[model samples]
Target: MVNWNSLRDELEQAKQEGRYRPLTVWESRSGTWMTLNGRRLLQMSSNNYLGLTDHPDLKEAAIRAIEQYGVGSGSVRTITGTLDIHDRLEQELAQFKGTEAALVFQSGFTTNQGVLSSILGPDDVVISDELNHASIIDGIRLTKAHRKIFAHKDMDQLEAVLKESAGFKKRVVVTDGVFSMDGDIAPLPNIVELAEKYDAFVYVDDAHASGVLGKNGKGSTDHFGLHGRVHIQVGTLSKAVGAVGGYVACGQVLKDYLIHKARPFLFSTSQTPAVAATCLAAIQVLKQSDELIKKLWANASYFRSKVQELGFDTGGSETPIVPVIVGDPAKTMRFSDLLLEEGIFAQGIVYPTVAMDKGRVRFIVTAGHTQEDLDFALNALERAGKQLGLLG
Candidate 1:
């Protein structure tokens, strides 16, 4: 018999500990503002960096694609599901990243898992940054490779791991180009130099960096001018691209290898026609204009500065995703709840997502946010902070 009481007790325990994440149903399109539970709130926790999620061009492209190719791809890419739009999206992504070839997966998570698990084996080793995304962690777990994690972005520690991995048949170094929670960028140039010195391959998950860094938002590779230097690049279209799925940009040989060996690619259905077409359109938008990217950074800079000026501790953030550390889970939850009540929607980050004493309220600033919108949000935050005694 199933022990349902144990499950219920676990749920109660989680809620008491402030570890339970309840779903918020949005009644409107998730844009700069979110409509939830009959009220409109200024959205500050979304990943829609460039505000393209509700862009008319993307919506129209998706509609056109649906009318032409129907809703779903009907099968996996290796079978009869590869559409013209899929090939076009891959080509566009490769060109965007200046890579020899690119391959699309079901999502950013699956992309990391597939790439790592397929290429690595028992005799290989994976050296990762300690704060890399959970998807990367799971990807490493899937492989039989010996895993070595260095303190977050510690070049000295990374080199130590590389020195110890001399005997491994293959050494792969992986990192997130942008740390999502802290909004810090990985030192790709330094990582590349280390990889060259240690004869290891470099892989970076640029999910947060795409459309948010480099020249016209070309990502970390372009940001650091390390084109053709880094070996593997994985990114998500769901972020700034305002679409779905993820991609791997690499040399043609690796693409070919992934096509055959990556189980997620082999087993998963192809992306819907609408998703592919919409992503293609979004890429075109990215290439054609730097207006949105500039606005996004400007907004990020403004919001980060305002929050810091309010005496909030935004821990080492260099991007729009700023974390206001509250240090206590209950206080952080209270702050978030108060912000929600005041028509602002920023989620509280607690244990397991971060350390016990590092609970925070993470804010994501988007390009669509006008100065008025930002000021309004900041005012709400200030009032809430004072009321909750969070302001110093």
Candidate 2:
């Protein structure tokens, strides 16, 4: 057998650098709450923004799908794998997004992989946001395109890159609608204007925004009110929608291209019927119910105000995702441990995920958390911060 000692050395190096995340196994999860090692705790770490993971409607849909269609699709979408549920989900997604067509992939990761690899070649240029998601970075790298990264949320730098790369066969400007780490909205209007000026294609990964920001939780495009300006809108059922899989909403031409050329969509097994069926139900809930969204924003606003009033830096956050910035990685991890002890379950995010010396304890709020829950979590946070010398 080939020696794998070098891989162990790299893993050790990652651990030493405070970048290796040994994820804590969760025993179970409820609405904005979870159990770990048999301890029930308030969950501020999950991305289930609407608390839809175990939603009654969503659960029932999944249960029915499991009973009717069985567990897995068991084949790639190209090979008798596109089930009726998958087709319905795609059609419904296209309608919901106000786009001509849509294509579902195994996940948001594979969505990027499909689109990037299909549309880009050696002569093309992909101008990406510096702080875009890791999946986007990997997808761009996989393509033969020349990847150019602009400063995080910097329109001037983006335009500069587009201008400098004068004669590429094609150009694509990619960005995250809501940056997952920092929780700030991207300047899509400016990006759209630049794309028009340079004849560049536009792509936005709205993973974090899909069920949190837009009208009836439509997403960042809806938040910014730039409906037709974006060439492609990539989103996930995993994050805010509280399900599995991902999709890209774009024009018929783009969808057609992806269907014929994207390797991930061609090779990967389609989403399970239960997952697709549940996701469709979740979207219906999003479209019809504003009550949950209102509560979600209300809770987020309250938490932000309380946390800020208590004197912790939240790092430019304007949404439910709040980060208590901790300069050192060890201290950030300690902060998380302390929060867990206090019965709050927020997690620490460290480098190389964020910049060096900018580790943070990131807390995600949802409609599921009530006023009393927020207050309880806030109280625990204050105690932990004071004990860690984060708040004076």
Candidate 3:
């Protein structure tokens, strides 16, 4: 038998270093509050920004879809799995994004990986933002293209990199519409200008910004008014849309290319009819209303102001994601635990997620959170920070 002692030791080491992340089960819907291990806690770390995950319309649509289409797609998209609802969702997605066409993938990560890996060859080059999501990094790694990383949202550095790639067959500049960890918006307009000057295509991963920015939540491209300028736009349905899947909104030719060439889309089974229906319902809601988006920003602003007033460091946050830097991993974990004890459910973010010296407790405010909820969370956070010697 293989010795498992080394594995045990490694786990123990991870535990000691406060990097062993154990899962927490939410007993209720991931909305304003959730039940964890029988305790009701104010939710602060969920990505359900618009609270559409449990919306009545979304639930009803899912149920209706189940009655009509059954449960699974049974086969990959390339075969017989592509359902009529999937095409409808793609049409709605393209209409919402103002793109010529859109193609959905199994997930946001797979969308980035598949598109990058399929399109770029060894002769091409990808100039990516240093602080882009890990999915983007992994996708770039899968491609044989020459890769160059520029400083986070630094246009000058990007220009320098693009200049160096002049001899490459094709150059693609990729960046996140919103930096997830630090909650900072990328300077997309500037990046687009530089890309134009350098003769490179601009690709933006608008995962976090999908339902959190732009008019009617069209995402970063719409937020920056760079609609037709960006070559490829990627977003997630799981975040604000509160559904499962990712999509690439581009021209018809690129969508066709991905349909034929992208391994993830071709190999993985299509999204269930229920998911497609749920996403469709969610988008319908977004197109009809902006109330949730306004509420989310209001809650975020209130929470951010309160936290900052408490002498906490909220680094570069312009969105609902507010991170309080605690520096040490153990201390950040302790801070998170104390907040949990106070009935808040924010999680500690440490190394591998962020840098060791940048360990923090990240809170994601949502549309479901009321001003009263924000105040309650702020008070709890202040008390917890004081108990942990994190605040004056």
Query: Which residue pairs clash in candidate 1?
Result: none
Query: What are the lDDT scores of the predictions, listed in order?
Result: 0.93, 0.90, 0.94
Best by lDDT: 3
Task: Kindly list the per-residue Cα lDDT of model 2 for residues 1-392, writing each as its tens digit.
Answer: 99999999998987776667686888886566778899889998888888899889999999999999999998988888889899899999998888899999988998988898899999999999999999999898888889899999889999899999989999999999888898888899999999999999899999988888788888888888888989899999898899988999999999989989999998888888999999999989998878988999999999999999999999889988998898898889889989999999898998888887899999998888999999999999999999999999
| Model 2: lDDT of residue 127 | 95
After superposing candidate 1 on the true structure, give the runs of residues whose Cα lies further than 4 Å from its correct spot: none
Query: lDDT of model 1 at residue 367?
Result: 95
C-alpha TM-score for every candidate:
0.98, 0.97, 0.98
- Provide the global lDDT of candidate 2 against the true structure: 0.90
lDDT accuracy of residue 380 in candidate 2: 98
| Residue pairs in collision within model 2 | none
TM-score, candidate number 1: 0.98
Model 3 vs. true fold: TM: 0.98
Worst 10 residues of 3 by lDDT: 21-30
